[model samples]
Target: MTKNRHFEIFLATSPGLEDMLCAEVKLKGFRQPKAVPGGVTLRGGWPEVWRANLWIRGASRVLARIGQFRAEYLNQLEVRAKEVSWGELLRTDVPFRVEVSCSTSRIYHSGAAAERIAKAITETLGVPRSETADIIVRARIENNFCTLSLDTSGDLLHRRGHKEAVNRAPMRETMASLFLRKCGYNGQEPVLDPMCGSGTFVIEAAEVAARLNPGRSRHFAFEHFATFDPEAWEQMRAVKSQRAPEFHFYGSDRDAGAITMSRANAERAGVTAYTTFNQATVSDILPPAGPPGLVILNAPYGTRIGDKKKLSALYRALGQRMLEHFKGWRVGIITTETSLAHATGLPFLPTGAPIPHGGLKVFLFQTDILK
Candidate 1:
């Protein structure tokens, strides 16, 4: 019989991406996931955890909650920590680390709490609390209520195990996915990224449409857990058979080097058949051959140089081209600066999701029709 597992999963995301993360979780079948400031909390088993890690594009990491308790005092924390199911979750040989965050209600010292929890894991589970931990388990003490979670994905899933090549100010995969979802891309319509840098948007969209598992080619921290079932994980990974999609995913960059890197990244992602890379400027982009789809661009805002003389004209030209060519389609534009976005000259509204990228707050400007 299969175990009726009950575990907590935390979907880690950027500061402004919490709602989108929760929305993605719900879209992935989680009926009720509590949206916190930086992430979401849900209860489920290993299967749900695996699926979230595989399909959640906005999530950086998925952590499985293992324990929760209230400790008003350090002595109570020590006592409550002893009753946790450490033997079931950790092995004697595995190395682990404790990360603690504390708020009101008597847990005043976060470092002390983290040390106590690490000691408890070491004493009870026989697992050494090594600094170089294969897995990072998170502990949060809010109003003296403590919650423990184990990191399932060792690294951020947006790494995608591909993207060896990128150019100046390349957008992150997580943000790219969020913007695409905001555009309502269903993978059935043609998608184009005229300013594609390293093909992040196109590659991630292809992965989504083909039903490919984003974590298939990557490794996770949960694989090293004591309760990890290799056979079950293998079965889950077998679902990665979804390959090329029928919709066309076109990516173009003015730099020939970017186009070459896009093709290489696409091949590595195993979605080359569904993607096309070209060396073309945004002004040169023509309407796709198939039905009208979405056009997304993360143009240069010249944040560091503070030069707007040329980029302003670029934005105006971009808006002009979209108005002239992509008449019936939709467009999604992410910009670090509002003034540059205003120069687009397109009829658009704020997506209400302000995300952080490259240490700067960004917003998504979307228009269903280019007027």
Candidate 2:
């Protein structure tokens, strides 16, 4: 167990966007943030953890590493787990769940390892265990070393407690923010998503430009922790750095239902004043009345059999429209197939590393300002 309040906090993000996430963490003034394989790691206490959850747009979840020990067997694990100061972190009245993973360890049975630790918590802290509990205790037993962490964010950070309505295959807000960073957006320029499904890109851009906190509307599991300070958290949340954006973000889709969903989502996210949604197809999309900016979209790529040919034609049409109409504007197109991206014939720079999204490998194809 940690003798002091400070602990290592891990901000989990999608695999391929670690660099962008690290950039955001650095820009946000996080202390000594280091990019790892799956996410970024920083050293801080509870307050830093809370702020990361509230402000970091690219993180999918926040984890607090509480304690660790070496245990070669289940008996040793149970004994060592009981020795940790559970009362310092967990409340007896609250229910929690334990999830464990084991690899290359003598105590290789993850189920048994989880059971031993859960038993220790139940016996030592008098807390009840439930599979559906919101408070999570995660344990990993790898190479004879055991590490324990607490899931501070109750739900995924992408939920954001807003955006109730969504379209099919909607882009997550976390992914959208990272992609925007990848496109070199810094809240000063305008953004447009021509095939906006549920208005994710536009709403995210508006939120970034307005300097809104993503977790302002939501509750976290850490609120129930014994170490949580409600007063300090309230003060942190009360401080707003909101700024007026100079330009508006826009989204348009061929489906009227998608436009309706996007409008509702934007309103719920409190970006309606800075965002606009329209019902229009890709061929009909026109540049908004402003200085040239970014045109980013997550177009549909046929995942099923025989869907690629039709999507190819759609891509060609999209490319032709942008080539003819949108001069001096950059484009970021996300798709699963390079052939579909090739159909656009946009002067795309080198394709980025493939990002795993919705069980398919997707890559970002970007271009300089179109001539």
Candidate 3:
């Protein structure tokens, strides 16, 4: 936490979309981004940390690696933890929380490890511990090596501070952005979502096309850190390079209420001018009049026996509509069951790994532009 010292920054994402997130981080100019299992990693100082929280769309949370050490025992762990320059990273006036996880090391009890680290922070930095604190210190002891990091993103990044309304099983904005990226959306092409619950995909696509920063309307936990520079952050957030999108994003759903929600959410997200929401069923869907684009939908994959039977027919109808009307449009369908995807008969290429979403494992089934 020394002044201007670079540290490892971890961008957390859904498990199956690490490569997509890594590509986004690399495009955003993060230094040497490397894709790991659950996320991406890079090295930078506090300014880069601030930028990541402010601009990156695919990351679910941002963690700043403050420091690490080898600790074989609790006493040694406590001593080393206390020696970390907590004052440089945390404010004594801010209440903070410590979370610890131990694996394959002598520190088997996570609670005891958390308590020891909490005690060290309380005694050395004079910071009060609070379970409800927004600032979080995370410690992981794996194979006798303890790495400490700060959760710079207090709430999950998907809470983009917009979209007050949502439908049942709506896709989060973080996951939606990554899915759009996986579908080869880069803001130039228009996007359409036939099952646009709450308009997540359409709104996210419009934001990308307009060059709007996902975190523009939200706040981050790093604002509470001792290293926070409000002046610098103000400048960073103010210098948005937004442009008017030439192509419009589109969405529709069978339910009238979902269309209302989509319009409201798009207006709240400041993309209403660039988006259009309509009330329609799968068979009623048609491509917009201008050009070929991407059609992505999070189709319903019901869990119950009767629900699955109903959803299969729904998927079949949707596929039939796409094949008949959406020629020249690429498609990305997200569903928990490949059987449902196959029911579309859309000639989907090799599917991506299944991603965990809303307690179900979902895969992205993509197709080439239909002839």
Candidate 4:
């Protein structure tokens, strides 16, 4: 593709996080970003695709719309698919996979449509099709219109190439980043996670404070494409706008194993210097010296097994601790139950939309700076 040509680049984010991801896109200087239901769409070429994968922390995947056509029958689908410049787009050395989904179209059989497209590509480009390939070509047939996109991010972006260990209460990095952004954290001050399972929140906050790119240590599927430029990608990725953080991010967990996992994950993420993980219970927490910032945590929803009463006591303890010691600090808690959040008894502001996490929908209940 030419440098001046603009393609439709879609950055996929979790549900209820579209607008927040759009704000990040605008801040990163992407052109004409519009937030939609499942993702945010913008206009750019290959470089924009690379930057979106490398820079955007909230996006789960970056999809580049490569082709679009109308196909009513399998014959028409094959013809249109052959017209696509697959050879120019993908290298013969790299095996690729095709995924198809159909809705309200004459080509109702998804398997048939996929096989047609796969056969066309194999015949034309002679590239092997693998059931599991890092390079993915996705097609959505909706209302007789087919739109093809490259899943430039093969693995989900949340696997940030660090964090070899995690606790039972695990949170994906992408969701953690959005929740932190929703809490009005702009990397200006300190952050703490009392129930910091695997240290997702604390480490994300520390990375933001240091101006580190989340995708720095990972490999994306886009690197395997024929259009990838090694020199250009290296130079762009090498440009680090790192800022030394003034305050250390804090995390405390009752589980000693959780604390150890948090420390190791921070070291792998290269944020150990900017973070401090303590083995402490909620009642034992003391606000760090120097400033009052944000205290955010993803608390247990008490979904599995029993003993929700004990969980309620845990929430009450957290609330009491925040009220008594964390004066002037804002608080954000994510939980699946409203009653549990209310049990915290912190004066919380109205919450945002519920975010789908695991099998449950969790809400972020935030409080104004404590009195």
lDDT winner: 3
In model 3, which runs have C-alpha deviations exceeding 4 angstroms? 304-306
lDDT of 1: 0.82
Question: Each candidate's TM vs. the true structure?
Answer: 0.93, 0.97, 0.98, 0.97
lDDT of prediction 4:
0.91
Off by over 4 Å in 2: 1-4, 304-306
lDDT (tens digit, per residue) of candidate 1 on 116-181: 888887888788888788788788899889988888888888887866888778888887887788
TM-score of 2: 0.97
Across 121-149, the per-residue lDDT of candidate 4 in tens digits comes to 89999999998878888999999999989
Highest TM-score against the true fold, candidate: 3
Candidate 2, 29-58: lDDT as tens digits: 998899998899999988898999999999
Kindly give the number of clashing pairs for every candidate: 0, 0, 0, 0
**Model 2 root mean square deviation, Cα atoms:** 1.5
Candidate 4, after superposition: displacement of residue 175 in Å?
0.9
| Best-to-worst TM-score order | 3, 2, 4, 1
In candidate 2, where is summed lDDT lowest over 10 consecutive residues? 1-10
Worst 10 residues of 3 by lDDT: 301-310
Q: Looking at candidate 2, what is the lDDT of residue 198?
A: 94
* Candidate 3: Cα lDDT at 329: 98
